[model samples]
Every structure is written in structure tokens, then in C-alpha cells.
Target chain A: MKVELTLFGQLADIAGRTKFQLQDIPDTDTLQKKIHEMYPEMANMSYSIAVNKKTIHENTVFEGDANVALLPPFSGG
Target chain B: MSERKIKNIFSQGPIPATFIAESIQKHSSQTAIGGHSIFLGQVRADETEQGKVKAIDYTAFEEMALEKMHQIREEIFAKYPITCMHVHHSLGQVQAGEICLFVFSSSAHRKAAIDSCNEIVERIKAELPIWGKEIMENDSHQWKVNK
Candidate 1:
């Protein structure tokens, strides 16, 4: 399945783009696993996942059309 | 009818005093106890382990931020006899010592207003998906957050 992935903040800067597509991932967990595999640097940073703008924990299923975003810890007032 | 107001969220501009004044005016209750308290958070230039923070560039996951803000408003209203509450946060780049957030709450008595304001601010800091980049004097930057 194909999923749309978005990177924000420092991740966006390091990745050099805000949005990208990941192919061949079967589900959300696998997608996350693939991301960590592709970007080993991400393993050291804390982040959160939002599937179609709603935050979810591990084991959540990802429909192919969902818009997934990777977010770093927020620092706003 | 009472008015409900939502103001613009920005990152590099002044927080309007009207948001606070209007919240007070809207929440006025003749029979309820009367007092209001506000908490304003301002950004300051400071030295960090990485470097000197010259300014902050603020950004938000807007869809999620608004959703969280609405939930917070509802929770505060349900938890306290608050006449009204308002929260405003900035979006772009805020210079050092500039206002970034303004929270206002009004209730029958001073205690509820003060307590509600504090709770709301804490909730916002803890829950919202907003990010800030601390720009250094050397043209480098790092993300800023409360530890």
C-alpha cells in the first residue's frame, strides 16, 4: 500500500522536503518501521504520528488514503 | 445574544488587547460572582546550550491545534462556572520579549477565574501540536520546548 507521509520542524529540514510517499508498507506499524529503517537518524529523536490529522498510538491501522504526519514535540504557548 | 469571538493566530505580531477586553465583556453576568484573571506568555531572548536565542519562529499543526483548543474550551467550561474563556497563540516568527500567548478567564469570583486561566495555559502547553524554532545569533536554530 502507498501512504502519504509528512515531515515537520527539524525533521523537515533534515529530510530536505516536507512531504513524500512511501510504497510497499503494509500498515501503519510497518510504515513506521520502514521510516526508521530509511532514516536511522530519526531513531534518536522523539516523535508522534497522526493519521489523517488525529494522533494515534501504535497498532493503529492505516487506510491507504490516510495522510500521516510525523511531529516533533511542540513548543508553543 | 452573547457574542463568541475567535481571533487570528499569528507567530510574529502583537497580541491584540481586544481579545481580553472582549472576553470580559462577553462573560459579564449580573448574578454571578465577579472577577477575571489573565495570563500572558511572552518570548524572551536568552542563551541556550546550543546558542543565543535571537527570536522564535512559531508554527502549528493548525488542524490539530484548533481541534485541541476547542476541546480545551469545552473542558474548562464544563469543569468550572466560567463566564467565558479565550486563548490566542501566535503562528510565524516572534521576536524576543514579544507576546506569544494570551489567556483570559472570567467567573463569578476571582478564584475560579485565576485557577481556570492557569489550567488552560498548562493544558495548551502540554497538548497542542505547536512548534517553536529558537533562532540563534549565528543564524542557526533549534526547537524550543518546556522540559
Candidate 2:
């Protein structure tokens, strides 16, 4: 399965792209591990994982064709 | 209660003063609204160790931000007796001294409008999934976190 991944703020700068498709991801837990493997620097930052626009703290099974976003702490005014 | 429709709260670049003026003008006919409270967020230029901050470039998970904002709006309306509320935030680059956020709330009395407006501003800062990159004059940058 494939999922659309979005990187925001500093994460986007580190990842070098805002949006992309990652393949062969079975669940969010595994997808997170793969992301950490690809971007080691991301491990140091505190971020929340959102699958299909809702933040999930626990391991969640990807429903497939979902949009995943790595969001850092909000700073909007 | 019926679900309120989510609004597009984003505007590209800085928010213009004329737009704000027009919004205020549009409310003149609402005689029932005796009080209006407004909050305007302006980008501040701060001197950092690397250089002076020049502007802020904002980004967001648009789908989620709008969803979260709508939830907050619903909660505020349920809690307060405000007549109406409006919230707008800037995306892309906003230069220093330019407006980035506009929150306006109106009510029959002053207290509800003031309190709800304040709460909405705080909620937007803490809850919205928006990110900002502070660009320095010397081309350096850092991620902004609400304090």
C-alpha cells in the first residue's frame, strides 16, 4: 500500500520536500520507523503523527490511501 | 444543532489593512451587536544572535487546520453568546509589521465579545496545526514555536 506523506515547517526543510508517496507501509507504526530511518534528524524533534488529518498518539493501522502528516508544535498567531 | 460549515481561514502573504477596514464596515448594519472585539496579530522583527528577523513564512496541513478551527469555533459559540466570529490567518511570507492574524467577535454586550475573542486567539496559537519559519535578514532561519 501507499500513503501520502506531508512534512511541515522545519520537517519540510529537513526532508527537502513537502509531499510525497511512500510505498510498502503496512501501518503507521512501521511507517514511522521507516521515516526515522530515512530522516534520522527527525527523531530528535517532537512531532505528532496525523493519519487522515487526525492526530494519533498510539499505533494506528493505516486504512490505505490515507494522508499522513508530520506536524511540529504550532506557532500561529 | 446543525453543524456549522468550515470556512477557509487562510490568506496568502500579509493581510491588508483595507481588507480589515472593509470587514469592519460590513458589520455596520448589525444593530443588535452592541460590542465588537478584534485581535490583530502582527509579525514582529526581533534581533536574534544570527541576525534580525525579517519575515515569517507560514505553512499548514490545510485540511486538518480547517477542521480543528471549526471545532474550536463551535466550542466557543456554544460557550459564549456572541453574535458572530471571524478568524483569518496568513500563509506564505508575511513581512515584519504586517498583519498575520485577524480575529473579530461581536455580541450584544462587551464581555462576551471580549472573552470569546481572547479565547479564540489563544486556541489558534495552541491548537491549530500551523507552522512558521522565521527568516532572518542575513538569510538564516529558524522554526517558530508558540510560547
Best candidate (score: TM-score): 2
- Which candidate's lDDT is highest? 2
Model 1 lDDT tens row, B1-48: 213333334434657667657666766554574887889988888888
Please state how well chain A of candidate 2 matches the true chain A, as a TM-score.
0.95
lDDT of each: 0.80, 0.93
The regions of model 1 sitting more than 4 angstroms off are B1-12, B16-33
Q: Which tens-of-lDDT digit does each residue in A1-77 have in candidate 2?
A: 88899888888889999999999888988988999999999989999999988999899887667889999889998
The Cα error of candidate 2 at residue B139, in Å, is 1.4
Worst 10 residues of 2 chain B by lDDT: B1-10
In candidate 2, position A77 carries an lDDT of 81
| Tens digit of per-residue lDDT, candidate 2, span B22-55 | 9999999999999999999999998988789999
lDDT tens per residue, model 1, A9-36: 8878778888999877677788878888
